[model samples]
Target chain A: MRLFDFFKLSRRGPTSADTAKQRLQVLVALDRKGGGGPDFLPLMQKELLEVIRKYVEIEEERVNVDFQAGTGFSTLEVNIELPSETAKMAV
Target chain B: MRLFDFFKLSRRGPTSADTAKQRLQVLVALDRKGGGGPDFLPLMQKELLEVIRKYVEIEEERVNVDFQAGTGFSTLEVNIELPSETAKMAV
Candidate 1:
């Protein structure tokens, strides 16, 4: 692979920008594929909480989800605070 | 519904925090369910790109996806720039 390409792959971890992109990607994927049914968002919200609960402790109320528009693409954003020291340490 | 609950639902929009939260949820969903094999990330990246492309114009190279660890939870982030004025106006 080219040097720049290799560098890009190697650098693919937690960065503010990268995190933002991933969030947007997931949101759009769900919005388009999840179907905007009445229960869809709630189901997504429930499923999201369930999935997150497996990996990290979170404040159920503090959790937030949204959709955003940039220059051309729209993003779905998810944010939650971790609940454990061990979880942070594992990362 | 209680006033607090009503406010929460009514206020939900393209807020930055909400967007971030959605991103994290989607990423985790994919990571846990996407089965991170050699092709997983690439497939996710491809699928993400495809989904985003349907609704917005993006800077292909500038597009980014990442994963992050917060207090206890981890997040997947996706970021992309829109290519057309129409996409932003539609939001």
Candidate 2:
């Protein structure tokens, strides 16, 4: 049934689902980051830091929000390096 | 030289430049959210709230970090709703 149709689609190499998934992802990313639109990553990072800093004292370098592309995949990594409790108390 | 070469590339349809940009974007987005890898948005949102709560009191629903797919473009939106200073003081 559906499984058979999917298997038939895969004989061409990648399954239809995988290929479709791959194609859709690549198209969307390029348009947003380029396509004459403003890059939102830097903007987002700045605002995020502002909110976090209201309570926590953190160095700018300790906050990282990044989008990394690998092969056919991409990952969004959000990291915050929090200072020790003693450091927070001292401040 | 380059301009003429670019013009030649465009007459066929979308310029190579536009096509490459489009293709790259679509592929990257699909892969990140799918590809059997866990989505990062929910995880990031949860952790983000934990850090923010240390200083300001906020309801869990007030913070949002989301990835949205639209047409050929995708957006990453991070929003945090902060209460008034008076509200913070009351807390």
Candidate 3:
């Protein structure tokens, strides 16, 4: 093995389990926030897009909205990606 | 009026309603994640603290856990604040 391989082997980088946990956590939050309706997401996305456009440019795909369900509540997660610094400055 | 006062007046910063919306979103997400049990929160908090302590030192108050309920699901929101760069590097 290469010298760097040792570090790679010893160091535990983020695993799929970690990603799954994060996704589940966000999903559960979204589910509990009354997010099951089909139209709600699209409508909310459109409105948010408009509001954000006023400040910075963002693509539709960059805006993610989802919901999750748990024992007693739901969660709605809204992840919006911002433009790069140069892009923002130019806008 | 000061020059900055005009900007402050015209520029609409985040209002209480925006905060409320954000809170409600997170709450709904948490509620849907089956976060209603009082015992669950403390137990989860303890375990999480143990895990995070291995990587970085964090105050108990910096970690916030909550839940919210909605139409068909619940959400569990876990917010953990990390130590500053200098602090982490020192560790």
**lDDT tens digits, residue span B1-91, model 2:** 2212222332336554544331211111212222333233333444444433453455556544456544322333444443333122111
What is the C-alpha lDDT profile of model 2 across A4-79, one tens digit per residue?
2222332335554444332211111212212233233332334445543543456666545556443322233344
All candidates' lDDT scores?
0.35, 0.33, 0.33
Q: After superposition, how far is residue A27 of candidate 3 from its true place, in Å?
A: 10
Docking class of 2: incorrect
Per-candidate DockQ versus the true complex?
0.05, 0.15, 0.03
Candidates' interface RMSDs, in order?
15.0, 16.9, 23.4
Candidate 3 structure quality by residue, lDDT tens digits, A14-46: 665432221112111211122222223223334
DockQ of 1: 0.05
Sorted on TM-score, highest at the top, how do the candidates line up?
A: 1, 3, 2
Clashes of 1: 27
TM-scores of chain A across the candidates, in order, are 0.39, 0.38, 0.37
Q: Candidate 1 chain A: minimum summed lDDT over ten consecutive residues — where?
A: A30-39
Residue-level lDDT of model 1, residues B53-82, one tens digit each, is 444445666556665533322334454433
lDDT of 1 at B13: 65
Q: Considering lDDT, where higher is better, how would the candidates rank from best to worst?
A: 1, 2, 3
The lDDT, on a scale of 0 to 1, for candidate 1 is 0.35
Index of the highest-lDDT prediction = 1
Model 3's CAPRI class is incorrect
lDDT of 2 at B47: 49
Candidate 3, residue A16: the lDDT equals 50
